[model samples]
Target: MTFTFKKAVRSESKLRLALEGISGSGKTYSALRLAKGLGGKIAVVDTERGSASLYSGLPGIPEFDVLELTDSFSPEVYVDAIHAAEEAGYNVIILDSITPEWSGKNGCLELADLYSKGNSLAGWKKVTPLHRKFLDTIVNSKCHIIATMRSKAAVSMVDGKVKKVQDKTEQRDGTEFEFTVVLSIDRDSHNAVASKDRTGLFKDPEVLTEETGKKLLSWLSGAATISPEIQAEAEKAAQLGVESIKNFMASLKESKPDQHALFSDAEKKRLYVVARKADINATQQGK
Candidate 1:
């Protein structure tokens, strides 16, 4: 019901990156290279028939675990894969060719079509929420996420000749807006240019390598700060007695499931500890 303001500060956060290129532009290899530079245990959710595994043990590419999704590319399937990777302690996850989730077999497009049974508009109404949830999972995930998307060639008449140029990513329009950085890769050259770069790290098109990931990691580690609103919430939560904390959490889970889901396991543990401390302090004061 009230609003407050504070000095804006950048927090050390996980990466949300996207690589867009046509087939053979090396999205998988580039994603792995960047992950290697980012430096952590890595996992890949391969929707491209285990294509990611082919690069295993290659030079400059660190070994990574894989979860191949051969059948379904539904948003829920991707969400579950992300959670599984997070639970397994992966620091980075590469979603190789997220294009499938949008257009491939059993993807959102298919789901929409099936739901519509003839009406395209009717189908999206049912599929939109699931798609939003999938995007949210990527945005709020604890681990860094690098998603690859297939791009279609854009053609134009240049000097009365139709020339093929590329830039359009094949997912839903504006999907690039969700990522902190979006690299558009050239198929012939394998070079990448940033269509979007919130971090101000990239200036020109260049070949992606392990160093690219390392640069991102270095930038991400620069500083950290929490918002005033969250600090106030933490204080309030700490003041709650143990029983009250339990009740509050339950209520939050029921009423604000999305917000409750954002709390990492470690954060929940800290909340419990603070609440217990407050309860203990109250008991001591009564003595």
Candidate 2:
């Protein structure tokens, strides 16, 4: 008997980073440093009051193009700008703020909790084919992406002391943590850490000062040479993270543990068919 197999499409080694935290945490500073260390070629989406000017004096950086509100504030604008950057020969692309670009329309609010909406998966649906251009040109354009997000902070009184808390911000103005290297920038010596990488190893909560950015750049520099064993671990984490989300959404549609409310009974039953295909893909990818 003869067996036939098709060649696999190779994915490029690219970096997608999200800078999260309080205002004035120096997210841009960190991104520029990362870019500087990675061979002096970088692109930035200057949404944060001209993120370009914010770092004009930084080492190894010459100048940056402003992400005009009229241009990228709309989703279509994002596609145009990213495509232009890819063609302009920048080795790294920076989206200064991704939240303002997302207009909460056509069920965009549903993805308020997932990274797809802005930086997560469900946000992907909100933007649709329009956003796919971003994923391809920005994510797959053979360049590093350093996106800065305006952090949405929750406030609560802990023992009568009002404290600002960090959580998933709203979609229209902030991004949810899910599918990138999530970093919480704070005004101090400490910064919160969350890794949402599906294609690479993820780190845990660690302090992110200027020093942390240097370490990340070092790791990113070596990502192309990651060990096979480590690669397996990262992929598993990615799958587990995405799978957990699917199950969470499924549970919300149920009054009974095994029942779904959002979809018709017939539609819910078809999940098994999709799930079987996912399993096969996972196995082939060694996830």
Q: Indicate which candidate wins on lDDT.
A: 1
List the RMSD of every prediction in angstroms.
18.1, 18.7
C-alpha TM-score for every candidate: 0.72, 0.55
Off by over 4 Å in 2: 1-11, 58-67, 104-127, 157-161, 172-180, 190-192, 195-287
Candidate 2 lands at a TM-score of 0.55
Cα lDDT tens digits, model 1, 71-127, are 888999999999999999999999997898899888899999999988899999999
Query: Candidate 2's residue-wise lDDT over 121-199, tens digit each?
Result: 5655555555444445555556677777666677777679876765664343323332347666654544455535542
Misplaced by over 4 Å in model 1 are 2-8, 154-164, 223-287
Q: All candidates' lDDT scores?
A: 0.83, 0.54
lDDT for 128 (candidate 1) = 94
Each model's total of backbone clashes: 0, 13
Residue 71, model 2: lDDT of 34
| Clashes (candidate 1) | 0
